[model samples]
Target: MGRQRKIQRMAAYRRRRAARVFRGLKRRLGWALLGIFLIFQILAQLFYPSYLTLPLARYNREPYGLKHRDDMVMMEQSKFVSTRLELTGSYGKEQVDLIKLGGRLDESANFNNLSYYPKKWRWVPFSILFWRPDVLTLPITFDDKPLLNYTLNYSKKHSKKATDASISIRDGNISIKDGKKGLSVDANKLRLAIKNKYIDTSGIVRLDVPEASIEPSASSADLLHVRQQAEDIISKHIVVSVAGRQEEFIPSKEQLASWLRVVEESGKVKLDVDSQVFGDFIDAMDKLVAKPAGQTIVSVVDDREVLRQEGVTGERVNRLDFEQKMSSILFRPGVYKYISIDLEPIMPEVKTSYSFSHTQAGLQAKLREIGRRYDTRISLQQLNGEGWGASYRGTESIPSASTYKLYIALRLFDEIKSGRLNWQSSVLGTTVDGCFHQMIVVSTNQCAEEWIRQFGRTALNSFLYERGISQATTFTAEGAIRTSSDDLLRTIIGINDGSLAGGYERDKLLDMMGRQIWRQGIPSGTQGWTANKVGFLWDYVHDTGIVHHPKGVYAISIMTKGANYGIIAKITRELEAQMYP
Candidate 1:
């Protein structure tokens, strides 16, 4: 058994050796075949480049067809490809083929004007690398007139090579035998420059016609008539021409056409007719401006529909109507002044609305009676939402006067509520020559200054801004005290309605305002409820306040420019009496 085992081991070893040798021979044969394939590929590219391709598309270094015609031929294939396109042309059996293959031809080519190129051709490249094709452009003309000129910047490629680049356009001419020409462009003055880029060319084509002939024709009389008609049409226009060195005016097309016609007829010319003819036209227009255009209402209202009639057109409004309807609250009829009254708060629950009766004729009779007594013009108004007196001669932009102090007081109260300032905190008072009196007792200007200083001008202005009052248009900066009876009413109502932020209690502010001492202008017999303050100045007696009675708290203010104290007082009283009762 031991001898048999030794012989089997030797046999197995011999078989393993033979198997290793066979495996080695098979691997060597595979490697030799691969090397031979690579060598053949390199030789093919070096000897016949047309058969080669980029590595990405090549399947073992084989040629790949091009994807797009516009794609340039690969440099390796360029030498084997043709690059030019061919064109052929025929005119009445006369034919020509043109080869197109240059940078200049490509730059100026446009397919739209192929009619100009009475030639055509098919491009075919023999060499594999000649894959890119070029285009051909031909010059175009109309009746021997060169209509356009195009340029190709490929001058670098061909120093003196010319690209046929041009355009032609024509409109049938109207022939007039034995007729003088009206205008003609001068060929010598025609300028044309061919730039490489469209941006390099001038956008406007200027035609210079220095001379034109005009002669009477059989229809010349009719033409003259038409020209005269056109001139008349032009003359009717109000030519607003600016006659100065500065370019101040712009003329309309019709105006410019008129001037151009004149320049054509007469040799004198002006580049800008507006600057030349303005003075004459302005002089004529000024005369028409002097008289009012009937009457125009410049005032604007929130609801424009109020000024319009249901069917009939409303007549234009004038200053007189406006003053009577609008400014009546500010002053007496046909005047500018200030009117104010002391309006003390009545009991909130008082019954002031009595039925309209002839008993003393309500508030109207009271106003006439007071007007007779005071000897002053008085006009009462229902500003908030109540009625008292007759609608007066002025509208309601009344001087605010001391009543404006109420606004300051309201602001102070607001500051206290907001924790911005303490009620006990004191500010230095400013003593004006003649304005407000002390803080609460005497209506002194010093007190007004002190309140204004504490609040700060900026804060005051900001407050007014919040209220939508134009900063440029204000009554007083010091203490920012300015009030209109109407506005005061609106403001108080806003406060009551919580429109104004951090508003003061109505009773508290009204009580403080009534404490104001300048109450000499209060109109008697004009009773309703009144909660406001009055102010006085040299030659000015003003009172703006809110009248709160049982009917409703109506705000009323009266102002007069030129009137005796008694006269002004009477007018305000009458206005109030008429409005309230």
Candidate 2:
């Protein structure tokens, strides 16, 4: 028992000793860790910022907020947890970060400075965590006007004023000083180039600055009057013999002005009337006394022209005798001149022929054939000339994908023309022009939906029907916006033929359609240019266009089910061959 007690005591003492050693080891480890931590904090504070930044400048490192165009870009400014130490503050930290920037600008831009640049001193914070946000604005702006304004300002600053051609009159002689063309920053081109160059998602204030010739106020052509030619010595009076009767007449300024003209001939100014002009004067005098002859309307039967009725020939003042006598009187500076006159019989003509050769039978046959062969619904029309166009199930309504945007375009056009809306008039947040272009060229759905909502699809449909722009076409389709090939042709013909939109507005739509990016359909098939709007959804594919063929302009609308653009192109080629042939 004593031995057991002694063994227990020895074990207890050893246990106590082991516990103390372990405690000492743990204490030493804690101190060592504390020292390492202090060193790291010192180093971190030395290089990185100690305080937090404001709302904007946290780029690239542990970004807490959104980093997008117009939106503030967030990032940790490569700051240490404790930058209060003397060793803190990277000399060119922002520049270093910029050099180490991993992001890129827009694809169109090539900003070399973005990739690498000399380091600059970082902003000394007025207060810790109060550094200005490294907020580089996006080159792409939602308003798209800031850069535009900048470009305008830049152009104004750089544009040189043009010197107009100087005119001087001295000693009865006029001379001209050639105008000088001044240098001007082409603001439009500069805007485009800068936009393209800085598109790299790079910061907004990039200085990659990049049209036109500035014509002087007057060019050489404008100074044509500057060349001096001696004025004609006005004669006071002249004598003329009319039918063997002699008479004396005085000259007047009006008569002289009418008879004489100044001309630059062979490097000399000759203030005189030429032979052709004299003859013209005689003809004009004759017209004052002559009566136009009655013309017989002719009829063309079987390619043969026959006079339906006879008409009397009219008499005109015979200019031959008078022209011979008074030919040189005006240019010779004689005042008033009398000449012999006579009458003669003259014949007039009226032209008549049939023009439009509408391919009603042939186009109908071809459209029918195409529809049967393709095993899909089709619609086609020839919208150029006088005859009613041919079609295959063209009146039947079908789903319209992007093609439905045509109605929006047409309606928008009407609104703008009627002063209901203007080019800058807002539709959904964008300008009328902007939405129109986006709806037509880009074939975007959001803008179209917005337009329909704003303009009321029902009202638009009513307008289409009332204006005869479309008979059966509708804006709100049951399953999809419904349209007929004929209806589509009607709008296209309206644009191309001036039956719908007229003047500049018509040209704008046509131009946009011609340049629209989607061209895999009829445009690809036809040799000539095709201004078209295309649509596709699910198994439906369609193209509507006005094609300018060498023979004539014609409109074509092709809609299909379970088909692709290749098929549409094939159909276009077939129709082209048929119609043109």
What RMSD does each model have against the real structure?
Answer: 36.5, 22.8
Sliding window of 10 residues with minimal summed lDDT for model 2: 81-90
* lDDT by residue (tens digit), candidate 1, 274-299: 22343343334334332322222232
Clashes of each: 72, 24
Best TM-score goes to which candidate?
A: 2
| Residue 504 of model 1, lDDT score | 43
RMSD of 1: 36.5
* Residues 80-109, model 2: lDDT tens digits: 101111111112111111111112222111
Model 2 residue runs over 4 Å out of place are 1-359, 383-388, 469-471
Q: Which stretches of candidate 1 lie over 4 Å from their true place?
A: 1-399, 429-441, 468-485, 492-505, 523-525, 549-552, 564-568
